[model samples]
Target: PLMYPCRFNLSTRSIHELAARKAIRSLEGHDLKDVSEYTDHNSEKYKKMVEWIARDLDVSTLRYQTADDMIKAIGRPKENLCLYCWTGECPKSARPKAAITIDIVEVKPDATRTKEIKVEL
Candidate 1:
């Protein structure tokens, strides 16, 4: 649903918009692919990409409320998502982290999904 360091600050709204745009663009054209991956861990090759993201995206408080809006905009196109990006102290970078957790309450096929989701670091 979101990349690593999923936290976002409301101050950087413009940057947040750009990041959402990029995520939407990447997620488009793929069917049945529900996972989002950062795929960049401070690699020499992705340095440019990271720089571009920092320049074009705003994620100061993404995890706050902007992330919810982004996910809402994206909708449920894929079943699961895997986000992988640089997870340390950077600016507006995507990283890999667990988005949601699910526990089986019953062995029924129609078992209910968790009403509240827990994110793990």
Candidate 2:
């Protein structure tokens, strides 16, 4: 079983999709579970993805976590932490700043037609 701290947030979902397509396909049809405590945990899209992937992987069971339960497990005040990953809401004090951008390019394709990733800084 594997546990995901934040399941429903946009960034989390993007990472999961990337993993499903690239990372976890090698271990296909395996039983796995993702534990989360988001209030929107059971929302339609999130639950559907869970069920679909579980079936694709043949997972035996699926479960989720409640916000209170997660808070208790973390043993910290919500204000002291960045809950953006879980709630998709940035703290009031957080401000946006310029970020470095990088680009990825594939070169020298091989047997599987996959090639080395060239990152442009």
Candidate 3:
């Protein structure tokens, strides 16, 4: 199986806080347990723990495609492709400067007649 890293603009701290809250809630009936440690979100240990959890959750949530995979699938060069969806970085040349519209015409041939359809983009 191929593994691709998940990339998005979500906040990791928010996810960690939510998970920590859930953990604390789950330990409500436990006896002699120090659950106060889960509330420390700024510690290095907490950051590492949450990073692993967040990575696992993020990866399990979706199947991601890398920029190389997208380029190969679309048969386009990386320089000419807008890969902002796959990778967070966008090339300056790929940015759109103005809006453009295109019109397309489809022709259908029948036994004794022809039909024309016009489409605008």
Candidate 4:
């Protein structure tokens, strides 16, 4: 089984609340709605809710593990493991300092021109 622990934030809580409310309403036979009717896929709220659910599900086909359980199974020092998603505490070195750009040139054998590509890091 694959295990990936994660920390839920305000947005996740909000989605859970929304789902809960919908479930409760359906249970009470009041204003029941289909899952597709919850929100438009184009909306930011819908996107966030989907992302939250995916994260909560660990985007995995296998069983899940809790943060503490994963840490214990790893048998490595916590400092060496990246647990930012689970603990929400990122080490200083792991944080990005700034955006970096690199330019690459691609030359074609059949053409006289070269293409330049800009990549951001």
Candidate 5:
């Protein structure tokens, strides 16, 4: 199976925390656990994206507050860069699920902005 090494951080906000909590809660009885393989592994692929993220994070002028912050840090708004794809895994394989949840707490795309609401997906 394809594996991803992500750790759950307690410092993130409630929306993201809640989704991870919910996903975790859903797996309450499962034997699943995080499998670590990329131990201190540095490679060209990892370097490429970190550089990309630094650039996009600057261009977006992002100040992140949720999982979306991490997302926008690496991707443009409305762009969903799959976790598997970014890590150089074949996307056709079972996609490793991600715990990062993004809630747009606020956005001012331009000088003229107002309240925006989106239904939960």
Candidate 6:
């Protein structure tokens, strides 16, 4: 998804998008058949490929989001969103984080004109 269409908009995207595109593009001409030949315990070839790509992309740091974090950021219920791309399994329910609250105080030039606001996060 990020190779053809998204790569076309590379310059217009944010740093995060660009990094994602770079990561996807790194696998651009790799032969999946060869990668499949290696056992899961010996993933040196795949690891090296990723390392080379990261270096080529000149990224200071790269991190892949976990399935849980991705779901939380999406905000939608787990049943409503697609997780195949990340987890390869569909979860029936989501474990979202509890809501947070903060208090904000605003003060005007007149000491008497002060307002307190409660913000939910």
Candidate that would win on lDDT: 2
Q: How do the residues 5-120 of candidate 4 rate in per-residue lDDT, one tens digit apiece?
A: 22222123332344433433444456433333323445554455445555555773322244466556655555544454334464333345554322111123464222222222
Which candidate achieves the best TM-score against the true structure?
2
Provide the TM-score for each candidate, comma-separated: 0.23, 0.41, 0.28, 0.27, 0.21, 0.33
Q: How does model 1 score by TM-score? A: 0.23
Write model 6 residue lDDT over 44-118, tens digit each, in one string.
Answer: 643554565567769766444444654565554556543433333323332234332221112234641212222
lDDT of 6: 0.37
Q: How well does model 4 score by local distance difference test? A: 0.38
Angstrom error of the Cα, residue 69, model 1: value is 24
Candidate with the larger TM-score of 1 and 4: 4
lDDT of 3 by residue, 1-121 (tens): 0111112222222322444434333444332234334324555544444555456577544333344654566554566543333233444443445442211111123432212222221
Candidate 6 error regions (>4 Å): 1-30, 33-49, 87-121
RMSD of each: 15.8, 13.4, 16.6, 16.4, 16.6, 13.9
Q: Tell me how candidate 1 scores on lDDT.
A: 0.33
Two-way lDDT contest, 1 vs 4, winner = 4
lDDT of each: 0.33, 0.40, 0.36, 0.38, 0.31, 0.37
Residue 73 displacement in candidate 5 (angstroms): 26
Per residue, candidate 1 scores C-alpha lDDT tens digits across 1-121 of: 1233224331223323444335434444332232223333334423333444555556332222233343354453223321221222322122346455422111124652322234453
Off by over 4 Å in 4: 1-63, 92-121
Name the regions of candidate 5 deviating beyond 4 angstroms: 1-9, 13-41, 59-121
Residue 8 Cα positional deviation in candidate 4, in Å, after optimal superposition: 18
Error of 2 at 86 (Å): 1.9
Q: What digit string (tens of lDDT, one per residue) describes model 5 on residues 1-121? A: 1123222221233332333223333434332243122211254432333344445446543222333444565453433333331132322222345433332222244542222222222
Sliding window of 10 residues with minimal summed lDDT for model 5: 1-10
Task: Count clashes in each candidate, considering only residues at least 3 apart in sequence or on different chains.
Answer: 23, 1, 0, 0, 0, 0
For 1-121, candidate 2 gives per-residue lDDT tens digits of 1223332232345535543322233344442444232125556645554565567668776555544565566555555444544454544333334332211111122521212222222
Residue 9's C-alpha lDDT in candidate 1?
32
